[model samples]
Target: MKSTGFTLETLKAKVQALTRPERFVHILRVAELAQAIAEANGLDAQRAYLAALLHDAARDLPEEELLRLAPPENDVERSHPLAVHGRAARRLAEAWGVTDAEVLDAIEGHVYGVTPDNRIGMAVYVADVSEPGRGVNAEIRELALAGRLEEAYRQAIVSKVTYLKGKGVPVHPRTLLAYDAVLA
Candidate 1:
């Protein structure tokens, strides 16, 4: 993938245009936290911000539109179209000229979970779940801010699985893999 040659302002405007106001607000919050965590962890804050900004680009899109971008391959994504939003967002980002695999992976995996190897993606994942506006996972947020990325990501995945299991919601298969990876 090659650079879209997009300046930050242009990228922001494009994302803002693609997303609903509420969803865009959430994206901004995630981007802020991701950038903070990246800075704290000595990663590329600008890259993290770019990834986070695009992570939820398709979150508010209609199910049909989401499927159109990235068709469901399994029952979870088929029944819960929202599960496909991350993949759709990735495709959308690709179409919009995002060239970084880490960025694209971060955007796609933000909705489920990320590989431990993807440091930027891990930051984005933790930030997405712990960002202030969510009003939950403060400890995880603090850990990430403290540069304890491994611990923060571990806690985030555990919290997610625990919450979903408690609520009787089926955990996405990819999420299960992330959980297992953290445990391993």
Candidate 2:
């Protein structure tokens, strides 16, 4: 609702307005981690934090509306339904008067995983996977605490890919590219 002052409360409000409670917690965690990564990468930490907090604002939308709202050329056209979050998020950003191109792009690109022209997007991308509550790779905590955040991210990505493969889910090409870039 309030777009002028980007406080944590405002971020939580924005996220809660659009997502479930559990999802809101993930956004908060990602926002915290995204801010840390932004600072480390010399980016606008505030912007990254806000972007991460709202990145999944539309992730749990109904499948039909999600498909209708997404861009036809979007990378997830043929893959998992979760890919629709990007296009939905971009539209929601515009509707909410989110002005910063970098922040909006961070939300739009959070699910796609390609190289971003802005550090805010990268921060959101990295934080989306590295957040603690995902519980996808809790064991990576050791490496993460050892100052190996990037390595932890790679291992997490590997675990995600392996899980997706086992479930017969088609892994997005962009995800694989991101994993390779991080591990390389």
Candidate 3:
């Protein structure tokens, strides 16, 4: 699907300029992983890569700026201001001439979680959590590489919830809903 007027290289440059050096590298890794997962799952690899590449465009934005760009829609999002970056990123992608619905949906849902109908969003979400650069265990990566995307996504969500609980951090309600939806 057509997403943006800019080429991948141009978009990469823009993302690099927008994020920290380390975050830029992580974005690249996520894109690589997303593309691999898409290929394995018979989805559009290019679209997955593009969505992953722009997924974190607003990740490093100041809290005030992020909130200004996209206000939190719930108590979970309000408590976890960074979670709103997904919405902000979607806005940024649109501003950059990305009009593809799938790509925008993926970007908007990469952080919190999307509806169960959004397979592209699930691919990006799982890739973001399981990319090599993130130090995710090999088993999770293998699951994605093996085309078991739903399993991998479910695992990632479980792990995230467990980690947050262990650290005494509040779990986002959307994450719990996603976990349930994926299980269903």
Give the whole-model CA lDDT for all candidates, comma-separated.
Answer: 0.91, 0.71, 0.87
The residue-by-residue lDDT of candidate 3 on 67-139, one tens digit each, is: 9989988887888899899999999889888999988999998887777677788889988988888786567
User: Among all windows of ten consecutive residues in candidate 2, which has the lowest summed lDDT?
Assistant: 1-10
lDDT of 1 at 117: 94
Clashes (backbone N, CA, C under 3 Å), per candidate, total: 0, 0, 0
lDDT of 2 at 43: 67
Residue 28, model 1: Cα distance from true site in angstroms? 1.0
Which lDDT tens digits does candidate 2 get at residues 122-177? 66776887678876544564454454555555665677678778998777777677
Per-residue lDDT value at 63 in model 2: 74
Stretches of candidate 3 above 4 Å error? none
* Clash pairs, model 3 backbone: none
TM-score of each: 0.96, 0.74, 0.93
Give me candidate 2's TM-score against the actual structure: 0.74
Highest TM-score, which number?
1
lDDT of 1 by residue, 117-138 (tens): 9999999999999999889999
